[model samples]
Target: MTNEELKKAALDYHEFPRPGKLGIEITKGFSTPEELSLAYTPGVAEPVLAIQANPEDAYRYTAKGNLVAVISNGTAVLGLGDCGALAGKPVMEGKAVLFKKFADIDVFDIEVDAKEPKDFIDTVARIAPTFGGINLEDIAAPSCFEIEDALIERLDIPVFHDDQHGTAIVLCAGLINALELVGKKIEDVRIVCLGAGAAGIASMRLAVDLGARRENMLLVDRKGVIHRDRDDFSKLNKEKLEFASAASAERRSLAGALAGADVFIGVSGPGLMKPEWLMLMAENPLIFALSNPVPEILPEAAWSVRKDLIMATGRSDYPNQVNNVLCFPFIFRGALDVRARTINSAMKVAAVKAIAELAKQPVPQEVLAAYRKNSLSFGPDYIIPKPIDPRLRDIVAPAVARAAVDSGAARLPYPAHYPV
Candidate 1:
């Protein structure tokens, strides 16, 4: 859609529906004044007292158990960098609506006017007690890494920057299925990430953590491939170097990194990779050009040389869209259910494996007609499961929660319905 048409639709779409997608609703029957009084004023005070006495009871007394804060400073909204706080509200609101609709999780999107890292961190930390978790969205990289680290360190609740880990987890899951289709092993694969931003770094880390050998991965930034040669680096860049450090120093440029690489992950920017780059890759290449609005390399452009390529993009119009929406909701649901203190690497790996396994399951009859496959078996085009797929929340959540429990991040004991 054109920019003007998109804006007009966004502005006019929420007309006469109580301003937007969400509205407060009474969960219990309290029609009479007496019932209302008991539910609201005097009787509600009792529950408040009880919660105050035992702070853990607040989950029982309030919506804190299932609500998340979609907090942002609007500095890094989806592909539109540095749009400021007010401008980011619509996207944040849309995210909250998605959280609610997809996982039955309530979301309050707070766009802080403050741009400074310290200010943003301070504001969200103070207000974090109100929700089960914090979903930090659309903040720029480097800063996003710091914010998430600080928040996770400071708060007991699960704090996730969806741009980083969410996208990474889903991307890894897609890679798992993609690699399987091509008869490749994770440890043996040479992967080159085009962007050294949040998603790129996180994807590399998750891939490494999930058994992709450190020497097999190479990350590229604006200054070309991130390597020991580059002196100017952020703290996050240092962390990335720990992974790429052991790789042969021979790999410097994007072309050097792409030589015989099995997977190409593009979180960088548009047109960073040419079709020639795809042709240079190992046979049965897996390419995820995940830049929004436009990918690093267009699918048709890449596919011209290698029809055998397993390709994906950030755009939903494509067959395998590597969007974070598939990961965050299910991850949060599992974390919340288990009262996970943090969503750690173990939990993320479990999520990736679960999602990969789910995609391989037999496609239900209802879905079979749409794809026209005899069995909803996984392959190149069906690597990661779609966000709208009903089985996702049910499948991924329990696995994450289980991992949380196993990893000692869970505040609660194992549930009776643990597998569920």
Candidate 2:
């Protein structure tokens, strides 16, 4: 479809469906007067009193255990930039659709009308009890870090920012398999990230957890490669400080940074990564140009320069797409299944491993049918699993739940229904 056609279709999709994408459906019968009375008065009071006496009963007697809050201040609404809270509701509701359709989980998309970090934090903290977990969305950098840290410390339930960690999880998963194909070890690869926003910082940190060398990774921004010797280095935020302090002081420019590097990850905008830069990287390099709708450099242009590299973009039309939907729904699924107190590092690492391993296994006939392919296997072009694969729920979530239990992040045991 053309861009104009897609615009109209998206608008119609949200507008025609009762003006919104969500509604409350009664899960129990109320056809009879007796059923109605039980649904409201006497039946409801028993569970209310029980929950009052023991707060844990809320999970058993109510939807709190399965419900997640998609909270956002709309400071950063996808590739569109800061678009305000009400403007971002459609996106949040779309998020709700993904959660339900993908993982069979429920959600409440809350667009908070607070711009300041403290006000947004206060509002979410006050209303935190209503949901089992919180999925922070679209809030801008530095403040997103603050809001998440405060809420994670204050709330006992799992709190996650999908834009940051979700992007990282999927990126690392594809990167893991890409490294294996090239016969390079994670700990030994020289990496360069072109964006230092929420997604970029979080990705590099997770890469470190997965055995990438901290001292070897380089973080770059608009001014150029982030280094202490630069004039604006002292103005860097805390997250940037962590990277800047340990950033390899080898090269100061983008061209210089890519020379001899094994990986070039661009979370930045279009046409920023010149086609000539691909030749500067080491043999068998990996490129993840993840700008949405448009990438740093088109795959065709990059391939013309370097045939030995594997490339991933955010577009579904491309092979090895880096999509967050591959992990977020299942991450919350596992956390909710285990009644996890928090989604910890071990759980995330487990999720990344599970996602990476899934691509190497035999592709289900159903998956191939959906993608219009007779055969698909793990290789340079197919390092990430498709988002619609049914095995994701069975594979990724169970591994995460196991990690939660093992890491003492869970409040309950792994479910009996889960795969052993």
Candidate 3:
């Protein structure tokens, strides 16, 4: 498509509508007085009494089983930072529509105008009863962590921030395949991240939680490496101290961290990693230049430095795209299916493994013939399964649901219809 076409499409997406993508539709005819009584007046009171006697009956009597609240403060909408709550409505609406389209989960998009963490948490907590799960989206990092932690501690329903954990889980899946392709083990390798934002911090957390050595990670931010000597560590920054370890004292610049690093993950802005930086990495390095729209280092440049490098990016036009869409839909589907109380490290690890295994599975003859392509085996270019793959929901959701149950965080037992 031409640039003009792209611009027109963007305008049409917002201009052609009543400024929203979803609306409530009644299931029953409400033209008659009897229908109105059953829908809102007398019949609704029956379920209210049942819930008053047994709180769990709310799930049975109401829409709680399928309702998910997509809450946003609009502070961090995609690559656009701090767009405010009202401006964030379109993305929230889009997300709500996807929840319905993908997993049959009903969604209510709420744009909270409050900016303070306390206000946001308290507001969402007060209305927690209206949803089976709360999806916190587009809230700025650092603060997003606090809001999620507060709500999860106070509310019974599951609270998930799709930005941090969802992105981390999918990146881990790609890293799993990329490591295997390059004959590297995560435990023995050095990993360097170029951003200390939400996605970078969460990726580091998941890496260590899933078995990467603490001493092997070096986190870089705007003021260079986030080390112990930097006396400006925030509360959330201090929370990631365990991942810094001895490397905190050793490494200084991005170049210093990449000297012998086996993996390079860029969550920061564009054009950060140059050929010199890529060349400094260890032999057969795995690179995830995940900066959206434009990557830190383009795949061709990384490959130019080392032919053995396994490269991935956030753009769908690129090979081995590390998109979070691969994670959130399936992860939430699994969590919602079993009524998970919270998404924990065990569930995240299970999701990572499930996604890795999907791409690792040998392609069937029919699948190959359909694509008219070969060499689609589990390798550098095919490490993580793409979003359009049919097997994703079937494979990842059941594993996550089982993990949630095993971890003692699931509110509902495994459903009978969960596909193996």
Candidate 4:
């Protein structure tokens, strides 16, 4: 479809069916007066009293166990920067659709207008009781780091910033599979990331957690390579500081960083990476240009420059799309199922492995039917499972839930409904 056509279709789809993308539906019968009374006055009070007597009963008697809050401050809505809270509602509602469609989870999209990070954190913390998990979305850097850390510490329920970890999880999973296809080792690969914001930092950290060497990775922001010798190095946030280079004077620019690098992960804006940069990378380099709407370099342009490169982007039209939709809903599904207190490194890593592994297996017929493709197998063109793959819920959720249980982050046992 043309860009103009897609624009019209998207606006029409959201507007035609009641000016918004979501609505609440009654889950039980309320046709009769007796049923209405039972649902509201007398019947509801019994569960309230039970929940008051024992705090744990709130999960048992209410919808809290299956509910997630998709919260955002609208400072960083997609590629549109600082669009504000009201402008970000549509994106949050779209996230709600993914949660329900992919994992059978319920979502309440919350957009807050607070400018200060503490105020945003306080507001979310105050209302945290209603949700089983919190999915923070599209808040900008520095403050995003602070907000996520504080909420995870302050709340017992699972809190995940999808912009930070969801993108990281899917990208890392695809990277792992890409490395296997290219015969490269994560510990030895020379990695250069073009963006040092939330998604880029989180992706690089998760890569390190999966055995990618810290010294081998170089993080570049707008100023250039993050090096210890830089005069403004102290000004960088604590999270970015951890990955600073050891005072390297040799390479600073994106072009310099790309030289001999085995991997290039771009969370930066469009046209930031040139076609000639791909020529500077190591043989069979893995390129993830994940900027939405338009990537750092278009897949066709990159492929024209280097036929050997394994490329992935954030666009569904292209092969190997590193989408957050592939990870967030299922991760929340697993966390909520086990009542996990936190979505830890182990759980995240488990999700990464499960997603990567699924791509290598035979693609199900139903998945092929959904995409209307005849054949799909693990190769340069297919490094990650399709977002519509039915097995994702069964595969990723169980793996994460198991990891949560093993890591002692979960409060409950392995669910009986899941496969043993």
**By TM-score, is 1 or 2 better?**
2
Overlapping backbone residue pairs in candidate 4 total 0
Which regions in candidate 2 have their CA more than 4 angstroms from the true location? 245-250
Which runs in model 1 stand beyond 4 Å of their true positions? 1-7, 231-237, 243-250, 368-376, 418-420
lDDT of 3 by residue, 1-420 (tens): 999999999878877666568988776779999989988988889989999999999888888877899999999998899999999999998888877776667899999999999999999999999998998999987888888889989988888888888889999999877888778888999999988878888899999887898778888888777676666655435555655544444567788889999999999999999887877878989898999889999988877778978889999877788877777777788998898888889999999999999998876666566556665788878788776666778888899999999999898898789864
- Candidate 4 clash pair list: none
Local distance difference test values of all predictions, in order? 0.86, 0.93, 0.85, 0.94
Off by over 4 Å in 3: 28-34, 231-236, 248-250, 362-375
Ranking by TM-score, best first?
2, 4, 3, 1
Model 3 pairs in collision: none
Tens-place lDDT digits, model 1, residues 1-420: 999999898788875556766666767888899988889998899989998899999899889999899999999988889999988988898898888887899988899988788999999999998999999999987788888899999999999999999999999999989998999999999989888888988999999897898777887877667666566645445556665553455677788788899999999888989888777789999999998889999988988889889999988777787878788898999999989999999999999999889888876776656555466457777787766777888888889999999999999976777564
lDDT of 2 by residue, 117-146 (tens): 999999999999999999999999989999
Alpha-carbon deviation at 135 in model 4, angstroms: 0.4
Q: What does the lDDT come to for candidate 1? A: 0.86
Of candidate 3, the 10-residue stretch with the lowest lDDT total is 241-250
**Would you estimate the TM-scores of all the predictions?**
0.93, 0.98, 0.93, 0.97
* Per-residue accuracy of model 4 over 47-109 as CA lDDT, tens digit each: 999988998898998899999999999999988999999999999999999999999899999
